[model samples]
Target chain A: MRSFVERHTFWAIVILLAAVLFLWMIFAVWPEWLIDTLGRKKTFVNTLLNGVTLGGLYFLVASGFTLIFGLMRNVNLAHGSMYLLGAYIGYEVADRTGSWFFGLAIAFIAVAISGILLQYLVFRRMAGDDLRQTLVTIGISIIAADAMLAIWTGTTYQFSPPDWLFGAADLPIISVIRSSGDAVYIKYPIYRLAVLLVAVAVGVALWVFLNRTRIGMMIRAGVNDRDMLAASGVNVQMVFVLVFAIGAGLAGFAGVIGGTALSVAPGEDIRYLLASLVVVIVGGLGSITGAAIGALIIGLAEQFGLAYFPTYGVVLTFLIMVVVLAVRPQGLMGGR
Target chain B: MNSSRLFSGSFSLRELHPATIVTVVFLIAYPSFASNFFILQIGAYSLILGTIALSLMMLAGYGGMVSLAQLTVAGLAAYLMAILGDNSMGVMGLGWPWWLTVIVSVLGAALFSTFIGAVSVRTEGIYTIMITLAVAVAFFYFVRQNYVLFNGFTGFAGVEPPTLFGVYWRDPVPFYYLTLTVAAGFFFAVYYCARSTFGLGLQAIRDNPRRMRALGFNITLHRIVAYFFAGVIAGFAGVLLVWFNGRVSPGTIGVDVAIDILVIAVVGGMRHPIGPFIGAIAFVLLENFAIDLIDRERFNMVIGTAFLLVVLFSPDGLLGLWNRFRDRFRFRGNALLGAERVNKDDPASTGSLEKS
Candidate 1:
């Protein structure tokens, strides 16, 4: 019994707390139904939608960060650069070809290739060395940012999404909550809905990929003990390259999505980079579920802050971070 | 010497070599020989930056914590100075006596750093880095948004150095001398403390916290104290930094500046007490000249390249390079003098940890 606790205490406590929080969240959303039933303007709907969308994007970026850091123990500070570069590449492709699909495809491919080469050329040597890897990645990011500035200029650029996913639609589920003949449907944009859906799909797909496949098993094993895995006759180096590329590709994809939803500019890389850090910290490093959980909490907290307290919206995020640190330095998930 | 052996290692705390005296004399006379613009802008500014970087150096070298929040702490000091002392912005300024304000700002910043140290001390390696990064990022955003207290983006201005002892401290010569004196005092203090038991214990923890803890030292308390002392140094520099610029703003403590402090410390070499000072001078020179030499937009890229090169080529920085040259000649002298028998167990070899 004691051995059981010593082993399972980390996950047991985390999942239990998560279940409780999830139930509480469901109850908290019940207020929206009440507000909708009264036929009043559903103010919480927009905030909820935006928060989920931002969280999805944050998850997309941070999962990649988790992948690289978890499997190889490398802290790639330049992951944010990949995100912004993806936005720029996607923007350029969409601009010339008038095809959002092509833009995303090309951006994903380009960033993935860059990630592979970077792993081989730079991060490979500093694989286990955190300090050098951080410094080197920071250098890469600075150079990338400057080069981006030279080409993209410092001005903000908005991505044009394909027309089908661009407009607003009635909140279809709210029909059950509305009173008879007083139907005032909360209209949220389709792009944001699509963003949230895509993010969910990506999360589910990654979960399956990490848990179900041969490569996935190796990545989990590598994260647990890379040297031992390598000694067992697996080409852990190839697995490392694969994970790094995938993470970079995910960041790029998120960049395109983020650029379309909001706007991309010079400082967005650092902003998202910092956001990813917050996500990983709150979620626990090197875990997919942790990133997902962290992204949602951070996303929801930020949106609510922005909605209710417009001026102090930014402070609320940090306040939550401080609370998390002071309360549980290990993070919500208690992952290794 | 035997009585003090446990605290001071093999070196005497009051030992002052001939080179120290020459360096001191040269520094004291630098403003007289140089132009006012050079003395005030370059010399004094570098010392202020150097001192802040030195705080970071102490943590990284002695405490085994590489925190990115030092600049934020310094910015906190600078902002506090504006609020406590006289600021023309008029909204939050207390218009108190200068000395009182200085004391409060330094202590307040130190206290703030102790809190940061508390939050960060539990995590090891990259976790600590991430947590500190989070704090610094949050601080930047909080200051930027709180307009009533921080005056929003533009921040406060017209912060003046005190007219202490009936002499204006902001005059070029006086300001240069003041910053120099502060830099030197802090440098000697760090050198002295490094030889003290507390400093050695901190270094012991840096190398192996488990072993240090086994010996019954409270690691967390020591780290927090180190951070507190570092905060006081950085906060004092922050006060000087505000006076030098005559303003305080969110930009002063931005993420870029925080990272820049890390770069300055790393490039100068983290091992020695004098490394941050050297790094600051190099950084100031780079900042002043990099734009002209490279595409103006790519100034950061140039710094990035230099930093990467240093990390890759010289882990110990410029001081390491100096040691290499000195070691080559010293090896020859040792061979001629029949002192080649010195090995890793020798006290002299403790300083040379860069050997591959």
Candidate 2:
């Protein structure tokens, strides 16, 4: 961090000033002119919070995508299918067993098993052939999407989080000062806050798992040089299967969580898949940090665009991606 | 390489293969015998789709870039034709002459495609697919949302082809002829280019970029130019496609249709210009008739399985399968001839070599 600031002092200072301004905007009671120029403080805070939580959802899906790509050099186009499948399975399980957590667990396990089967049966045979592997994934996604549509019948399904996680909580931020000179706190959904918390915990856990653990070091080594790792007496195939399972499992888990936050249907796979692609592209392929940063930027852009410019919300995100590609083709956090 | 042999592959009637001659003759005479349904729905539709898929094949097969945005480019042309020409939507139709509209829409789509190529060519290989897919999806969502220019969800309709030379061009026979002309034009254009200097350089870059760069080729410019040519083909096909349907909608360029284009290219074979047309015919036939064998909803499943099988067993697609089968038969014939010759020379050795 110090080295980054030392190397790019101008950028660091600019970022610091932006951070100060942003913090001030979040805390200070807005002036009448400011409110007239932008909007009510309540709307601004809500949009900001929504962007952050949505970024959390995007992180959950894209982190796994990056991990798989990093370790296996596999694009895994079927990832979106896995997400939709997980959501469907989660919905069914939760409905039957009367437990959302159980459904989440089962969804993760089932999807992980499917991922393992794919890695073993399909990808193993065509190892080192990147294009063929990606093509096979595309084929699988088509079949899987059609099969899911047949089973689920295109109905939108939203997870009903438990009663405890339902309802909104009051935040400490003041939205407005009433005529009586009393400040009104902003109220936001508890479930969204929890989602953000879970995402942060997962992100931190992933960083530690990749950096501190022995297995994590092995995985990183494999990502850098699979042949060298194998030559050094590592069970390269086993590591690959394990990484694929975790990656697929994370996507499945996010499917259920995101389904609760939003909703799941036939086309959500493509939506999330596109989101992952853009995030990974902007954030840098195969890096968890890159995925998180990309997700946050995209999520914020989406919310802000939707709030300010309704018709061109998607274009805003696309413009960000184009700009990122133009400036840094490798992505924001991706290494050369 | 001899310069004569290099230039020998240019399009010329005298050099046309017998198969090419037969195919052209059959196509010209097809409408006379076939019903309007066969002529329009099957023939014209396949040719239009084949032309579109041909663009994808040109990029994937020659340039080694599998773009999912070909349909999006086609959709852009279709939308431009509608918006710039005339539409029933009472939207922003400029009511330009059909000729003007076609020229503008095709050029617009080509420039758009060149821009897409410029953005995506920053990355190589698999990243091409991901970036193009994102761009395609982004365009879909944008068209679906923005009503000011794109007319939002319900896009322009009542689009028609011009009546030329006292002929309603949209009529089945005329449409088939029109599509056939365009398809054949692009087919031979791609065919000739594949053997041209630029195409060979592209294929060389696909094989080994670092070496090609060392050999002093402007690899990036070559790729962008390839994209421009592909865009031109897809743009023309798009104009025909919108006319065929008499409307343009967001659904026309959805992600599903985008994948369908890729599936068509892969299944027919990406190795040759003729492969996309062959695949398009098969796809059109399956799309029309698959309902007879199974539920309409299961069509994707069947196509997806066929795609999977092709990728798994015959990566070069159906053309590759045919080549392998013919090679085996020819090898067997050669072996038999060799055995006979050996027998004439030495019977004992021939027995040892021929028993199997």
Candidate 3:
């Protein structure tokens, strides 16, 4: 136990403790007080639930960024704009077809195509050059954001799930006032649960793909030694294009999920992009596990900070980034 | 070892003697002849952005650290100015004299940037970008959420320039000269700094950090100084920006502005001091007039396309294109000198035009 604690002390242990303190504050020590402060236990439950789902969305977007950064030293500043493009496309598709799954499928493929185009057209020429590539991506993002604004206007768009997941799910637990016996069941949105489940399923799939497959091995090898990988007859360029497509596709997919949960607007793209950056930095670049760990901390901190402090919510998030950066510059789980 | 290497790195290898003279004459005479719209809206605005972008170029070109928080440092100055000086918004303006406010704001910006630099210089390449970006975004949200400090989204306005020597500084002609003077002063500061021991050493450190460290150079200390100096320049521009707009707000220093600053620097060509000003002129003109020509909402699309094409075609920027166009009219002997200098400064210099 001591050894295990020591192993995860800085990374997993810190996150675990944060999550526990939140739970203890809400669930154990001050449930009645929270109910009093918030006016209802349902609101508290919803807030906590929102944090988890938000974290899941962050995990989905950040994993793709980590994967691409790990394999190639390229920084895609356009990732968020691509995500916005996906969400906008998904919103249109789902609105037209009235089918949720079809929208997700189309948005995923379409965004993957866009990502590939970006690689073949822009990033391919600037191979191994970080600054120029970053600047190019920033320009792409700016153009993409502008294009979306032209088409979608400035209004926010929210997605509705298919019939099976359209409504809220009522749980067995109820919040009751100690004096009046007034009670209410905590009802959670079914779509948020779906988002979480989808995120987890994708997480497992990615782990398997990275750990147990041939291309995954090549990717790991590519990350470690690109020159040697190319010398060994592995097509490094092909792998880069592949990873870029997959990373962008994941962001697009998450965009659909996040757009559904929080609604899509003109500015949400940068917000999510910044969120992904914080997650990647906190999780350590190029580590999927680190991405997940980083996402949870950011998501919880953001939502929790908003609930408690309101005004200082973003500050809390920034403080976490600074602390993590100072404590472990390479990130908690990042080894290489 | 030529003293003229100061104006621009290899990209705009034109000697400063001719170019500086030409640019200065044009600038000084611009307000006297150009219409108010041209002077105040386009020319002055370009110079302001150009100054800020030049600060970014200093770090990126010489130090190899591309900071996204330049706008934030500049905004810090404007915010301090709004808080300290007389303002229409009856909020935090302490009603200090203009001279004291400007001094304090500029110094405050330097101190703020130094602290941020200490934290960020620990990382390199993409990590440095991420950390500085985080700091910029954090400052954006900090001002937006903390309403009492910055008046939230509405932002304090009516931050007017003080009248001195019976001259209204906010008048379009006077403002143009004011901005021009500051921008020109800092442009030369960057020029002279490039030729100094610190600037040359920074470039050497950028090319080979370990070798410089082994030879007893303090890499961190140098990087931090670069950030401080850049911040001071940006702060000067920010004060100008606030006076130009006659207000201070969260919108001015947001993440988009930070990225726009990067676009300006890169599109101008980070290799030279004049590149940023050139890029800034193009950007301001496009932003102001492009909306009339194209769909207003689609203006950013044009900018993005331009930025991409510039990066792909001439990574050194428009100045690079000018260099190519002018090289045909040049004597061949200087070209040989350029090649020899490249070999001396960076022997393994990839024959990439981007580097040259």
Candidate 4:
């Protein structure tokens, strides 16, 4: 009984606070039947699931941004353009092949190769020069964005996964919810679950790769000091090429996932770029752990803010960034 | 023979002589030859942008701090003038006269810049850049969202330039000459300041702050003073901008335009005062005319490419190239021209990024 109290106390307090907040919000708004639809227990659980999946997608997008910034002391302003490009590529591939899975594979490969080639060609030459590299990448981003606009024609395109992945289902263990209206009594997309799963698997893979591989060691050493690594006979050029590719690949992967979730549009690139920049700034530029922490905080803040304080929802993220900068300019997890 | 020639040429290029000649010729001939609207609109716009960029050059070029919020400061001054004083129309207005409003607005901008400079100057390099960016973004949101002060997003409209010498100054020719006179005045002021002790001290701080501090310079005060001076320049430009557009919107001060100012400073070369003029003229003309010929959507591609190429190949900027070209060519007398031995390390020194 003591252990139960320990586990439940925090959640019980949170629930009570949430209930008070909800009543306050309802008082602000005119009474409506919509609240009843939203108030169902299953709906709450589904919304929670949806919020986690969204956070998972944000993690995927911010991960590449963090890695590129952390490893290469260069700000890739064009990362947004890469995201947009990846989405368009995936959409077109899916359209042509009539297969979402095949399209995603093609999108990942195409964006990954392009990202690597871009690094090899341009960023490799701009090793020490930070500002110039920023300008060049911005130039590249503008060009790529324009090219995409020419092809995509400033239109928003939405894509849905195959029929099998269209509706939600109940897991064997979590049978508290049963089927209702062609879903498991909670209408949420299965693709969102797929995104969450993929993000988790990729996150795990990246963790293993960074901690357990020779290339990872080289990357770490390169991040610490490229000059020292070069003197120590590591092919620093090859390492940069690999790092840039990996960073770009992660962004591409995120693009496909995000595009499938949020419709692909022309200006979406700038939004993601800004989001990623905010994440990196708040998380600390060079820390992967910081990226995760930052992403989670921003995601939850954004979701909660949207639910409770829609008007100031956007301000919450920026305010947190300012507070973080004020308290610790190095960021939450930043060592240097 | 070499010693005699060097001695004779040493005093040839006086500080104000070339600038005076150019100013006089430009003021007299530009309005006379250029078309009516071109003389007024494009010319006035160029001058205003040039003046704004000049203040940025003082901060970024000399002080080595790139404040993206200069435009924000300018916007603040403009909006304050409209809201707090004679420019206001509604019940919320202060209802003061034009001159008082001008002083208050400009002072307000300076005070705001001082506050920002205090926080930002402590950080170095990219942190400084990001901090300024954050401030600018924050102000952008504050002004855009606050309907009571900035009229929400619509901002104030119908700001009129002050009439002088028995004429309404809104006429294109009058406005053009007005801008020219203002630009020329500020140009000389900045040029003279570069040769002044204070300006030299600021440059010293830029080159090496620790050494400057050891030499007994109050580094923070110097930076704030620089920021105040920059605020005045930007505030003056802000006055011109409101008059030009006849309306102010939140979109006027944006991240893209802030970055555009940086591009202008860098493209003209950060090393010289005249760089902004050359850069501004080229940028304005290219952005306006080039987009007409090409796809409007892809025009940014041209700008982006140009920016990259210029930063990569000619970090010294266009004016530096012009000086080089001028030195390379000779006239009928076959005399080798150009001031070749000017010391770049000296704050008063002219030319490119090379330190003498």
Instruction: State which candidate has the highest TM-score.
Output: 2
Clash pairs, candidate 4, are: none
Model 4 chain A weakest lDDT span, ten residues long = A172-181
- What ranges in model 2 sit over 4 Å off? B1-14, B333-356
> For residues B41-63, could you state the per-residue lDDT of candidate 3 as single tens digits?
99899999999999988888888
lDDT tens per residue, model 4, A203-285: 78888888899988888887788789999999888887777777887787788889998789987776677667667778887
| TM-scores of the models, in the order given | 0.90, 0.95, 0.91, 0.80
Q: List candidate 4 segments past 4 Å from native.
A: A1-56, A164-198, A303-314, B1-14, B81-96, B134-156, B162-166, B213-221, B327-356
DockQ, model 1, C-alpha based: 0.56
DockQ of 3: 0.61
- The TM-score that candidate 3 achieves is 0.91
DockQ by candidate, in order = 0.56, 0.57, 0.61, 0.23
Better of 1 and 4 by DockQ: 1
Which 10-residue span in candidate 2 chain B carries the lowest summed lDDT? B347-356
Of the true interface contacts, each candidate retains a share of 0.62, 0.82, 0.65, 0.25
Q: Lowest-lDDT window of 10 residues in candidate 3 chain B?
A: B347-356
**Chain B TM-score, all predictions listed:** 0.90, 0.90, 0.89, 0.86
